[model samples]
Target: MKGNSLSQVYYRPIEAAIRWAGLLRFQHEIVAAIIDSRHLAVTLNCPRCDELRLYIDRIYDAIYHGELPYGQNGITIDDKSLWDSPDLTIRHVDLKRWMLNHYSGQRPAFLFSRGERIAHPVITLEAGNALLVEREALKSQLEQCRSQLRALQEQRKKHDQAPPACTLCPLSDRAEATYLHIIGAMLTLMLGRSPSGTPYSSFNSQEAIASALIAHHGHLMGITERTLQAKFAQARRKLQSAVS
Candidate 1:
């Protein structure tokens, strides 16, 4: 009845097969690049779907001839639930061997379809291992971003007591209020955390959290590293002035 129970027992094998086939490699690469500088040097590319479609066609053929148990009408093997379930480990192993034996090389185009040129993209053993490593790194970065966002929210709450009165009391009083609000907004954007627990807010989404971490640390957020360093220097100067 539990969600994870089904995943471990029934869906894991299929999921592993899909992963090994490199279906989710792009997301893995993005996450890995965010977490480690070394990963940034690694080039990640998605396997062409046309190639995967050919494998699916072969699977259908095996099922049709009773070489494999499931078929096109049975349990839809391509569903994410089946792919992610742990129960499929043995199935995945068997499937991997089957794939390697029959689909590992650039097969003749005529065998796949009449009068069509097709290349079955083969993944070298080394590339498969690297993809697994990159996926783990991405999972790590997601966890780290979640923790960092939590800490920033706590800090914001502690600092939310009251705004200090403006020193220039007579001239442009609203300007100081606007400045403080702008600074608060920037901090929230940088931290990607919401204190109000709103469901639809950008801070709650995976993409927002991922983007913020990538921007701040991954060197992919458009701003140059030099700009970030300069901002850090300016922040330190402002802090020192406040203390003095």
Candidate 2:
């Protein structure tokens, strides 16, 4: 009934010794139960909640860009929009009772001997569905982007002879140069060669090699740390595919 307190939900202490199940059991079970039953999915199923969540997302965008997203002039959240519809509010009350009765205590040995606690039942069904709803929202947004791109291409076709207002710079030459440099650096590192063209005492580790390559030739190779990271990721994928 109170404002959704996010600090406890978001900022749990991270211990290196803990595994995924240990940390995420609370949130995980909440989602699992919601998806397993339709009645428990009221928050996600509610139209008012969808509107409120979209409004909140715009509020976030306003914070970052100093304007509402999607070129909207003005946006606001009202009291009715903040909470659920009457039916859903009653459903929420019932849902909390159900969770408390069914999933509130320690699991028996038959269920899970690993001792996953369901103590602080602060999370609601709507909150549990937040990630799934957000993912769906992203898919919708991406579809909108693809549609806009196709529209732009169609518009460009109508102006066949005219050049676009912004000409896309050709990056093939620069990309080829960067690719060659990376290959050369990787070959040298693999062969245990130092910058002075002498053999090093021992081969460098993959992480060390990546770091050294980025530090020595990142600017010259027209690469940033992020670009080098992508290259490294591609290389790893290639190696994984070959092994598989």
Candidate 3:
């Protein structure tokens, strides 16, 4: 009377061993308790019922017909004392083997339903070699994508903070021309000129343009007056082309 009930002895202990070995990480339980001692078939909670069936078949084969005896104490299935004996335990080595075969590798049988009936060995070891490979590969790809995203974000931030460049002259191709366009727009607005030749005094226009240009492009500040005059004329022509 010190043992589990007949219902518990038959499959519950084995199910617990399977769970202890970490084979049932995603499933809630093996299955609802449906044990038929006559035919000895128990439905499992796994999606592939056939796979479960085959797995159970291997367990039965090992216990009832295979080389290994039932448990550590050499308890046979016919022993009535085993029915209620809570001390009943499968040997650790056997249990380890059972965990490995069922869950570990890409068993040829699991490739398709057609091979489900092809019973092979079942071992339980919670092997994570395959999962570790996939996890590392995914982690590498995710890090690479994150690095690319960060680079794009940095470039966008720099572009947003900088002043706009003219599309026609494009600061990349002609920084001087682009600067001239900006200086001309500032001067035209200040001179009260409405896109017409009826501008304010040309002297004030030139002086303000020079001041604004020097403030922005400080390299022009040290140039001689004659050279400055020539650069101003060139800037005016470039500004006209940009506006047109």
Question: Which candidate achieves the best lDDT against the true structure?
Answer: 3
Q: Write the per-residue lDDT of candidate 2 for residues 1-244, one digit (tens) a residue.
A: 1122211211111110011123222333333334321123444432243433343333333324423211111122223332222111112222223324544442322223233334342455776587567556545654564465355335534544345653454548666454445444443335454333444323456566557655754544324566656766665555445446
Candidate 3 minimal-lDDT segment of 10 residues: 1-10
Which portions of model 1 show Cα errors greater than 4 Å? 1-101, 104-119, 161-244
Question: Which pairs clash (backbone N, Cα, C closer than 3 Å) in model 2?
Answer: none
C-alpha positional error of residue 47 in candidate 1 after TM-score superposition, expressed in Å = 28
Can you give the lDDT of residue 115 in candidate 2?
36
Comparison by lDDT, 2 against 3, better one: 3
- Please give each candidate's TM-score: 0.25, 0.20, 0.26
For candidate 1, the 10 contiguous residues with the lowest summed lDDT are: 1-10
Ranking by TM-score: 3, 1, 2
lDDT tens digits by residue: candidate 3, 93-133: 45445545554443322122334324543333443565455
lDDT of each: 0.41, 0.37, 0.45
- Candidate 1 per-residue lDDT, tens place, 44-103, comes to 344554443344445545534544433122233543333223232224334444545666
Top TM-score prediction, candidate number: 3
TM-score-superior candidate, 1 or 3: 3
